[model samples]
Target: MSTVAANAPGAAGGGLEDVAASEASLRRFLHGLPGVDAVGLEARAATLGTRSIKTTAKAYAIDLAISMIDLTTLEGADTHGKVRALCTKGRNPDPTDPSAPRVAAICVYPDMVATAKAALAGTDIQVASVATAFPAGRVALPVKLADTADAVAAGADEIDMVIDRGAFLSGRYLDVFNEIVAVKQACRRADGTAAHLKVIFETGELQTYDNVRRASWLGMLAGADFIKTSTGKVAVNATPPVTLLMLEAVRDFRQQTGVQIGVKPAGGIKTTKDAMKYLVMVNETLGDDWLSPHWFRFGASSLLNDLLMQRQKLTTGRYSGPDYVTVD
Candidate 1:
């Protein structure tokens, strides 16, 4: 856990007093965030993406990326059987190597939290669920909170909630902010310990770098332990540049607030090369503090297979094929 109190709305030196004060105050704080220069941001991400990592460093990063994956299966056709298999995959990504590290968590829809919890019990892996009308935050606040509470009650370690982009883009910034606060509260378990809250911005719908930046701040101020890039249901999800911008948000948020929030870029990232680029971006932008699974995550399902293949190639002198890795 971070030093910043998750429930402390206005802790001294937390840099959240003004943001939590009022809707008007929040608007000012968000608007005051520096505007993003699109071209420059893209250039920086591209430059970092071009970094060449080989041999030992590449092997370490492959394992690190595997550990950072939140192996997900969020389909409407999801079943307990499929979730159980996915849980197995998350626990033992490479049967060929017992030394292979397990994934950080198994991400599924709210209803599958119990199934995943049962399947992944007695392991270090966590169970994360998507709530708040996931992919589309178009539901009543009560319903959303109930969805979140259900997941927590079912033993979810993390709750990924979607913000009302309709409310946010329509200038109802306080509504969006308060909704996040409410959902964060809903993540609390009966034991008083709460599931980590990851607020999804759905940046593709937000449409501008400036809006992404503002939404990042909005989520952090609203007490999200992590601010995710997308729900992965959007037309465009986790681009390198967007992920770069979010990394910047977390970095700046920590610098100002002393709160160490995490960043997860979901949806489109695939391939060991793609994961490496993101690692490079984090290594350069946020330094090593954000390098762990505690502070960064790659929300991917197929990306894990590629990472496993890369790991196998590193272990053996020969390249491995998809048939070698388990299919889940």
Candidate 2:
């Protein structure tokens, strides 16, 4: 089977419709993917999670992990003040120590993009917004497009949109594919640049490893810059086995298509230990090419605080008290 790929950076998405010209063809391609080996996958993920690093390398991994975080706040009560504070923290993760790295982006609702952008003006930190009726993704295509356009207009460097899992689970693969293509279109800016697109699969709801693998391909073919694991609101999000499966998908997709996409495992990744395991999985599965913040991220809020605490432990040779880091 011929593989489909998105265009280069600054290009939103194109030339993928023919690959899924019909529901049958799309279904054929998705279902044709190699089935996942559940037991082997889980065991490997467990083994990778047990990897250890020396004290010096552990500091590097902790810093790298800190830099790859998508500092996020997606609550209904989010305000401009909260968003600004989040941006400040993202720009300077550790206030007392200047060595802490800045997070990749400040993730918030569409309305908070400008505030975040303004707060992080001098920094390279991207402002990412969740659109297309995030977490549920139950809106119509037009509404979803408008939602995406609003974020792009609001100065979001990245748009994290959710796939309509209902359509995907119903075998309406073409509908989901078309929606992603359309959302990619909506991510374009007037200056000919584009906000990077990240497609969220909310894996816990998919019910099987096979579905996760299928969704990963569908999103990439539709031109996602990143294939994300969850909305972080689910009962389960960003587990090691599921993340390993996604890492494998991107690895295979790139080998065939020659275009690299990113992966983000969001939610429930609070501890530095959990973050390190995911980092090890990325390194071992996809290698160092995907190790940077450009390709991998932890969709976390509290995880940064933990990384800060661990960082302090490494530098001071003693654990910081719970009150050491600000509770965001």
Candidate 3:
């Protein structure tokens, strides 16, 4: 499958007509979706109450995707180091204590992917890059595909691409779907170790729960390995309610397709408590199968400090200084 042909506008084999039909089904499904009423809130609360403190914490360690706008900034360096340190195995400076959970990957821009990859070399941590004009995702198809290819060639283990939400919202659902399928196809490596594709829906821009659900299903059907929430570029990013909607979409998709796709709620996740809430949602909505790093991920830069603080409190029964535990 040549990248050019895969993304060509209205290329033969399957054209916009198929996408229009899929969109019609999606719209019908969305219109038929039940409203967010009191019953739904109660059920969600009940599910949250069942999660254990330990399981929630374990989920936190799975993956932390950090986005750095400027690699030269001190804040960016600090965030990167913290992620690298968390992914380290075995004992830290505190020999008596066991190492913390490994972070699945460190996310950054294309130029910085190599730096993160080098820092995380010889470890289980992966290097991920946001390609195809992230956040807005308004660029041309060929440009986006080439950007993805360049990032992967530079050692990015995972490629996070934003869907053309404008097209989907404007009723051009198939265009967005085909773009993702083509981008995923372009991620192949020389040795056949292709980079994983995470399709960002930017849920904040999607407006309604119905739209979110439809976009989730469309992305999965179009071959997205993971469906992520926001680009963190907007004021409102990942929220509990929106995440709840997306979780239901992935769960329902799994039932129908028998393929388990990953879910990442990125942007604006700040504290350990916030991360824990997401973990609770995943546990309740998706169950134990999607509990590991392979199935779930959190994308944030400030979240690591809070998680570490909470872990220290759990271990020593006292609050400790930032220096006591080294950040990556």
Could you estimate the TM-score for every candidate? 0.96, 0.95, 0.78
Per-candidate local distance difference test = 0.87, 0.88, 0.67
Cα lDDT tens digits, model 2, 27-116, are 988898999999999999999989987699999999999889999999999999999989888888888999889898899999889898
Candidate 3 lDDT by residue in tens digits, 1-328: 0001111222212222244356566455445655655457556755674565664444343223111111111133446555344434211323334465445666777766676777767765667788998767778999999999999988887888999888988977767877887898888888866788888999999887768877887787777777889788888898787787788877877675566777888877777667777777877789888766677777776676566666667667787875764443
Instruction: Please identify model 2 stretches exceeding 4 Å from their true place.
Output: 1-18
Candidate 1 per-residue lDDT, tens place, 96-157, comes to 88999999999999889999999988898989999998989788999999999999999889
Q: Which portions of model 3 show Cα errors greater than 4 Å?
A: 1-98, 325-328
Q: Rank the candidates by TM-score, best first.
A: 1, 2, 3
* lDDT at 215, model 1: 91
**Where is model 1 more than 4 Å wrong at Cα?**
1-15
